[model samples]
Target: MLNALLFDLDGTLTDTDALHLLALQQLLQEEEGRVFSEAEFTTHVSGQANANMCRYLFPERSLVHHEAFAERKEQRFRQLSPQLQPMPGLLRLLDFAQEHGIAVCVVTNAPRANAEHMLRVLGLSQRFACVLVAEELPRAKPDPLPYLSGLECLGARADEALAFEDSVPGLTAAVGAGICTFGLSTSQPPQTLLDAGAHRVIEDFNDPQLWAEIHRRLDVR
Candidate 1:
């Protein structure tokens, strides 16, 4: 039986990817005189940890500089939070989880500020049992530590939890931790997510097939 629902915050729970992309594009232009294309953002920036993204995008910069850049980028993102929208069926899924007594946890590669801001904007600040930010963990997404930690925090085994993700790194983390993972398809192609080990790909929580799979999993349990 699924005892917990582990979710990725930015793109999975809320449609913040486009906002983030814009922030990154603006940041890159201001800081490095570079332009960040949407395809590049999807392929390189989305789903990556702040530190990793910084290193990848500005290898010549010092760690301190990268940290500052990340902070600025996130600040820009938060400024655009007013435009945030919850992923379709998010509230219904939360209600279902609540009615069924399933624990809901937010597991994200996002910084704590961004995570908190997004949740608050979606009016979901108090809905989750726990919110695990990657920076606070020993390792971030694509490493599985964050997802493993979320499962441990919920006192749920990987087999007893379902994870929702919207990026390759997030999928890798959740799947690596042994959780049944679903891709949100908000940030990457469905095939990319499937190749990254997602059990299924969904446009949002409203996908009937997602509910069907959930019912099937529950029936077996």
Candidate 2:
């Protein structure tokens, strides 16, 4: 049975990846006169945890510096996010889960502030039963601790839950946690997501393929 729904906040619920990239780009340009191309972002940056991302982008920087830079990037992204909206069919999917008595939660690698800001911007602050942030846990995505913790909070088994993710780390983490994971191609390439262990990839929640799978899993009419 489909007992829980796990969602990765940024790109899975909404197309906020571009804004995140823009925030990082603006900060990098201001600090180092560098431009971050999309290919570089998709390959080397997207879905990474704040500490890892900052270290990768500024390897010479100290942990304190990385933390500060992450804060700045998140603040800029929030400022750029007032126009955010839910992904197409997302509300409908949430409704389905609600109707079926399926528990819903958000598990993200984003910092707590960023996650809260984004969810509030999308009017979803009160939606999830649990919101798990990587920084609050012992380990972040690509390690499964976050997702495993999410399952614990929901009192759901990994095989009985479904996860929606838009990036490699998110997908890898959920799959590693033993949840059946579906990839939302909101930011990364579908094939890359599949390669990262996504059961299937879709452009958005509205994809017919996603609905078919959900129906097959839940055995609902």
Q: Pick the candidate with the highest TM-score.
A: 2
User: Tens-digit lDDT track for model 2 on 1-221?
Assistant: 88999999988998887898899899999998998988888877788899889878989979998888889998999889877899999999999888889999999999999888888888888989999999899999989999999999999999999999999999989999999999998888788999999998988888998889889888877
Global lDDT of each model? 0.91, 0.90
Q: Estimate each model's TM-score.
A: 0.97, 0.97
The deviation in Å at residue 120 for candidate 2 is 1.0
Return the clash pairs for model 1, or none. Answer: none
Give lDDT for model 1: 0.91
